[model samples]
Target: MLARVKLEKGCKSRGIKLSGALAAAGLIAAHSTKDLSDHQREKYAVVTLIDCRSILDPVLSSDYMGFYHSAILNTHDVSGGENLWDLAKRCYTAYSNAKNNNKHFTDMGDLNFLMCKAIENPGLTPSSSLRTAFISVFEDPVTDDTNEMHGEVGVEDYVGCSSVHGVGPSVAIFDTIRDGRLDCACVYPSPLHSRDQMQKLIDDMKKILVDGCANGESES
Candidate 1:
């Protein structure tokens, strides 16, 4: 159930496609009340932090990469009080890049833009099946309007999906950290690369998505 989306020229596009890690430098960053201390911050120092000022250049800015790097440099950044504009801009960039680069972009609409479009779709009911599907596919409650989903409410399981599927170089990097098969605990905090691990992730995800679709059809 990984959903990927892209943003371009202020427009957001969506795709039902595939589908993170890192350490912190501060002692507090290394270990949080909810996270583990086993992953060393030094392992993630390579991640870069995004600047808030990079919001204007949607086309060429590397903010999306910066956002992913920020996640690893300090996964704790999920709640570090960054501004909404910065996060939203980064999300837009990430989604756009993902759509352009990943094969998963086919047959998908942009969730970010679709939300507003839905609001204007008089022919569609908010409770209609299509609306529900659109929201389910792209409007991640775990990710805010800015589309950042790191430590957001009810979204620990989604961090991996959001990182890759959102838009940006982070998608590939997150997959690497996932190293593939993430257990339900979803505790691994860095990019994963083991062949066995990736195979497992892909298999598990395919099963989940396929079964969900079947169940939805049966219910209808």
Candidate 2:
């Protein structure tokens, strides 16, 4: 709880949202993949799924959930031995700048055009082996208004609040907050990667977030 508060404060100081901070942490933790062979590490990319409903239309309220979201792709040279905080700030800055420029909306047409081309040329689609790393950060809907629906809920109960499954990424992280506490689930294709390895990566990501919150470092 204390760590959460501190992290939130740090994010506010830097004009970063909690989702952006978590995304940064996920990417930083993903740097550990450098332990793998160079060929394997070269294929690793970070894809952040961000909610765009708020920015889509100013008049539309948060309740208007029309599937307004987009994915931000960020590739890192983890071999450079970059600082975690620095990398995090860069990730957040890129996302912020892109959104501020209204690229999210403008890119929709480009995405459609690319999809059409991919449909014509299926060869353009990446194979399963080329899957990138993915992280999705979201807030659970267990608010005061809907508290009655989740009677007798606890931290552990939040585990069932989210579900993630797909072939697009080798590793996918689903993150959410319930009752002011953060919860995350890391999933990977079983035969492709060992559960123990993925679990360790997830643990490292959590530790990074907690440490960032506890340290109360000023924005760099």
lDDT of every model, 2 decimals: 0.29, 0.59
Predicted structure 1: lDDT: 0.29
Question: Model 1 over residues 4-60: C-alpha lDDT tens digits?
Answer: 211111122222222211111111222222344434332111222222233334544
lDDT of 2 by residue, 1-220 (tens): 5666777777777776666676667766776656754334332355566566655546566667566567655555543344556666766777667767766667768755764665566456565332434554442222223434567464224343333343345565665555565555666766667888778777877888777765556533
Candidate 1 residues lying further than 4 Å off, grouped into runs, are 1-55, 58-193
Distance (Å) between predicted and true CA of 210, model 1? 1.0
